[model samples]
Target: MINICFKQSSSKILGFNIEGHAEYGEEGEDIVCSAVSALSYTIVNGITEVLKISVEHIIKDGFLQLSLRDNNLEEIEKCQVLLETMLLGFKSMEIGYGDYIKVQVEEV
Candidate 1:
């Protein structure tokens, strides 16, 4: 299963941690995993390249973690839309593939 946890402070998103694989199909044909990866990379690129915000991230097999490098509320706010969109995508996936994915939100 793919486990995703979003961390927030004062109702603002701070970052997220995602680990595991859907294992719903053969590696290359796992649509769940592919969707997750595409959304993740899009948000990462949107924040780091488009928004020009510094971020701390770790990418590895079946794992991806990302956090705003600075805690500045304004900077963090800039990422909300993209992050929230990612959340929506994940939630939608969970609805369809509950057996393969889990989503959680945590107050930090």
Candidate 2:
């Protein structure tokens, strides 16, 4: 199963951590994994490349983590929309692949 944890600070999202694989199909044919990867990468690119906001992130096999700490409130607020969109994508995936993906939100 894949685990997704979103870190929230005072009502705003600070970052997220996603780990593990869906294992829903053959390694290269897992649609669940592909969907999750697409959403994650898109959000990261949208924030860093498009929005030009610096963030802390780590990516590797079966794991991806991203966090925002030093950005000013304005930048953080701007990132909120993309983050929320990613969360929504995850939740939508969870609805369809409940046995493969799990999502949790934690206050920090």
Candidate 3:
């Protein structure tokens, strides 16, 4: 299962961590995995590219993370929309692929 977790700080989304695979099908054929991957990558790109936020993150085999290094309230608040949109996408996937994905939000 893919574990999708959001880290929050004082009502703001600091970042998100994604790990594991959906295992819904073979790698290239897994719709669940593909959807999640697309959403995750879009989140990283959208924030950095469109919002111009500098993200501190890690990317590796079966894992991807994204977060902001800037703690300014305005920047964090700006990121909230993108992060919450990502979470909603993940939740939509979870609803469809209940056996293949799990979502969580954690306070940091």
Candidate 4:
């Protein structure tokens, strides 16, 4: 499962925190983690450029967490769309059979 939280500091600004989890066969756990990490990296890298913001920090554990700071509604909205696309792509990947993953988003 993946849970993403967004915090808006202003009308045109917000931050995101992402957490993801997967239930995969033992041999495929690493692949699951790698896929999730890659998705997070793509999101942060893409948003940083699209929004012209800096990624303050990123942490990985059972899930991944990304924090960014930006003040552009247009960019933020674009980022949101990109994030959704990435998540959907990850969901569609067949890295492991009988594995399950989920993504969620929230405004904080």
Q: For each candidate, what is the lDDT?
A: 0.93, 0.96, 0.87, 0.56
Best candidate (score: TM-score) = 2
lDDT of 2 at 2: 96
Whichever of 2 and 4 has more lDDT, that candidate is 2
Give lDDT tens digits, candidate 4, residues 1-108: 445454544432255566655545454555665666687677777767756665566676764555445334555566666656665565465334234554334445
- Candidate 1 or 3, higher lDDT? 1
lDDT of 1 by residue, 12-92 (tens): 789999999999999899999999999999999999999998889999999999987465888899999999999999999
Candidate 3 TM-score, C-alpha based: 0.93
Candidate whose lDDT is highest? 2
Of the candidates numbered 2 and 3, which has the greater lDDT value?
2
**70 Cα displacement, candidate 3 (Å):** 4.3
Which is the better candidate, 2 or 3, if ranked by TM-score? 2
Estimated TM-score for each candidate: 0.96, 0.97, 0.93, 0.55
Ranking by lDDT: 2, 1, 3, 4
Cα error of candidate 2 at position 108, Å: 0.5
Q: Give residue 65's lDDT in candidate 1 (0 to 100).
A: 99
